[model samples]
Target: MTAPVRTRSSEDLIRAEEPVLAHNYHPLPVVVSRAEGVWVEDVEGRRYLDLLAGYSALNFGHRHPALIAAAHEQLDRLTLTSRAFHNDRLAEFAERLAGLVGLDMVLPMNTGAEAVESGIKVARKWAYDVKGVPADRATIVVAAENFHGRTTTIVGFSTDETARAGFGPFAPGFRIVPYNDLAALEAAVDETTAAVLIEPIQGEAGVIIPDEGYLTGVRELTRRTGCLFVADEIQSGLGRTGRTLAVDHESVVPDVLLLGKALGGGIVPVSAVVANRDVLGVLGPGEHGSTFGGNPLAAAVGTAVVDLLETGEFQRRAAELGAVLRDGLTGLVGKGVVGFRSRGLWAGVDVDPALGTGREVSARLMGEGVLVKDTHGSTIRLAPPLTITEDELLNALATLGRVLERSV
Candidate 1:
């Protein structure tokens, strides 16, 4: 008989991590051992409702059966086959993803940052090759408080000092404008502009949703200026926002769509830059590639993710459950909750500073058997998995209410 595995306590694991791991992230104290659906089990066997859902990466929830089965089947057959040669699963994944997003072609990448970088390159290339922009003089415009990724180039344009401080001397040829301000965006777009990259809903900057008609205005401006409109939907896409893509809310289509996060079904890191042929086809042979971008395992998992979206069940769940979330949060407004912004099931709740900081509130919630994450100073972001049952979600909210009341 095999020896049973001995599990270490959460304290022991946390102590083990303190010395060796990089001090980049200040995560919540709870140490998760396993998770399924909307709940996570700590090493000490305590279960907590998961409200963050890995920053929307686990939109389908942890260890989804279909995704797991797909990954298992791929693992048994094949895994990696770098872009140096073709792989069996890549074409189908690309086709299905493209069809789902209404794009013509797909450039697979490993992470959201890579997809954004690739989109930047494609836009610059398109500006020179198709739009007749001067070489190396092309510029891309981005919104203020944007949280595309943490790459050097991506961080260079960030308005947040924490993300940019000491990370540069950074890259240039990028312009920044206030988010949701159409006048500023219009004024920034000129003849040398290659593209305008914006997130449909800014996830990292406290789930900031733009004003109505902002997306449509962006589309019209991009069209009039002959520049590509790149939507970084890495966090806001993939059925997290009760829509196939956040842009779908306005019925506006971007010239380039950057997707990631849930594309791997919370199983692997899979991302892609999707666009029409005229935009994505600007790259010639050897221009851009990734060693493990379209690997068999990622493709297999991505195909499964697309299949899940095809059923439209997750999207429906987010939309229906989102109403409940909104109502619950609204009821807490004056009770230690100052305000909140939400769409679908994703929310950024601002706890009154009189109670405590967002981090303190998060810790209290953890103590109450709920797991959430804090951003900025007083804002706690809530994005439970779409698979969360109504009862489970309400229970989590009740825990949140109790935590707030205790803090007060």
Candidate 2:
């Protein structure tokens, strides 16, 4: 018989990781060992129901069989040929992804930030080349509290001090406007405006959903002013908010769609910028590229991811379970809750200050065998996988509710 494998417990692994890993993130003190569907077993063999979904990167759930099989098959066949040489899977993947998002073209990148940057480049080039903006004068208007990426240019326009402090002498030609305020967006864009980049729902800002019809107003404003309307759906898109794209909630379509995170189906890192011929075709050659931008391995995995989103089953599940989770927790609002937010399977809950902070609830919930995360100070955001059974969701919520009641 084979010897049983021995793995370090969660605490032991977390201790080792603290030294080597950069302090960029303060993750919940749980080391995941194995996961399937909606459950994660820590190194200690304690199974806590996953509620953050790797910040929505695992929206389809951990180690999805289809995506995993695709990755494995591609790993055995071919992985990378680089942009220097064309690969078989990239073209097909791009075509299908663009079709899924209803765009004409797709630019492959690895991270959400890269896709945002690519969109920025595409917008600026279009503004300069086609819209008659003066050279180096184009501006992209973004909202306050926007979390596009960590790159210098992205951090430059950020309103959050923590995200921007010690990060500047920032880039110029970017303007900030109050989120959910259409008039503010209108006032900020001008003749030099390259694009109006916005997230329909600000996921990182505690699942902040904008006022109704704000997205439609943005669409009209951008269209009337002849500016590119870019939607950063990296976090809120791909069925996290009960829609293929959250913009669908307002029936608004943007000129450019920035997609990432769950686009790889919880198996690999894949992102793409979906646009039409005029916008994406602006890149002739020697302009932008990534070493692994559209590697065959990612392409194979991406095709599976895109196809999975098309089924619409996961989105429906999210909507239903989300209703259950939010309804069950809403009663705590006046009693011990400081704030409550929900859409689909995503939620950002705030505990009463007297009961304790989000950290307290998360820690206590871990003891109860449920794992969620805190963000934006006291807000605890839950984004459970759509594949989780209702029984599992209810069980986790019972634990979650007990923790909330005690803290509230």
**Can you write out model 1's per-residue Cα lDDT over 214-283, one digit (the tens) per residue?**
9999999999989999999999999988999999999999999999999988899999999999898899
> Candidate 1: worst 10 consecutive residues by lDDT?
1-10
lDDT against the true structure, per candidate, is 0.93, 0.87
For model 1 the local lDDT of residue 393 reads: 84
Assess candidate 2 and give its lDDT. Answer: 0.87
**Native RMSD of candidate 2 (Å):** 1.9
Model 1, runs deviating above 4 Å: 1-5
Per-model TM against the reference: 0.98, 0.96
lDDT of 2 by residue, 41-140 (tens): 7766678788889888998888899999999999999999999999989889999999888889999999999999999999999998889999999999
